[model samples]
Target: MKTSGLDVAPVNLTHGPACATCNGPTRLTGIEPHPMRPRTDLQTFQCLVCDGVQTAVVSLVH
Candidate 1:
């Protein structure tokens, strides 16, 4: 989510989080590789209430 300039489309990881901007419950929507490092990802979380999406780095599930 923090990373940028992705070469390909991201995959959904199905994780959930609280929206940082709106403080709403969010569902994981998309995922992509970390541009700066390996074995990590930028996971996108979608807020159900505000319909906002935010991305953050998290360990790869598998």
Candidate 2:
């Protein structure tokens, strides 16, 4: 079997019960980028209920 991208580390998914802004029952899915670029690494998440965008420094480990 071929495992190029498949071998790559997986992005962590965190669930947020409430929206940070509205405090509503919403979830935030965070994906940590590859650790090569720590500073550039960002956490991107979208609210399933409100469609809100939240970003943070999740971290990376090469």
Candidate 3:
């Protein structure tokens, strides 16, 4: 979709996880608190090269 005119390219995720589709870099797009877990979050990411989206669960218990 729409960005703030800021480029998402060159913004790689920490540890540099590759996109499953294009094997390109991904950037974190969004994060939200998990409904069922107070110490967890749902993270959304988008591939910079292919524009593919991915979601993941992150725990905040550390």
Candidate 4:
């Protein structure tokens, strides 16, 4: 798998979430809107230590 344009950038976080793989800090990579659902959003995170990617589903309410 190639992550050419995934926007994997490292961010400075004083208190960030821990990585599931390496127990390291995670940084927000990108956010993508769901195609089928208007109120749903997908948040992508990358582990700073392990470089693992994780996707989280977020629901927006009015």
Best by lDDT: 3
Q: What TM-score would you give candidate 1 relative to the actual structure?
A: 0.62
Give the best candidate by TM-score: 3
User: Against the hidden reference, what TM-scores do the models get?
Assistant: 0.62, 0.44, 0.68, 0.66
Q: Where is model 1 poorest over a 10-residue stretch in terms of lDDT?
A: 6-15
Error of 3 at 52 (Å): 0.5
TM-score-better candidate, 1 vs 2: 1
The CA-based lDDT of model 1 is what? 0.76
Clashing pairs for model 4 are: none
Clashing residue pairs, backbone N/CA/C < 3 A, model 1:
1-55
Candidate ranking (TM-score, best to worst): 3, 4, 1, 2
Q: Write the per-residue lDDT of candidate 3 for residues 1-62, one digit (tens) a residue.
A: 86799543353455345788999888888879999989898888888899888888888775
Q: Cα lDDT of model 4 overall? A: 0.74
Q: Cα deviation of 50 in candidate 4 (Å)?
A: 0.7
Model 2, position 26: C-alpha lDDT score: 44
lDDT of 1 by residue, 1-62 (tens): 57667555455444477788788788877768999878899877888888888888976644
Per-residue lDDT of candidate 2, residues 1-62 (tens digit): 86666445544355654567666554445556646765456666677667877776644344
Better of 2 and 4 by lDDT: 4
The CA lDDT of each predicted structure is: 0.76, 0.59, 0.77, 0.74
Where does the lowest 10-residue lDDT sum fall in candidate 3? 7-16
For residue 36, model 1's alpha carbon misses the true position, in angstroms, by 1.7
Q: After superposition, how far is residue 53 of candidate 2 from its true place, in Å?
A: 0.6
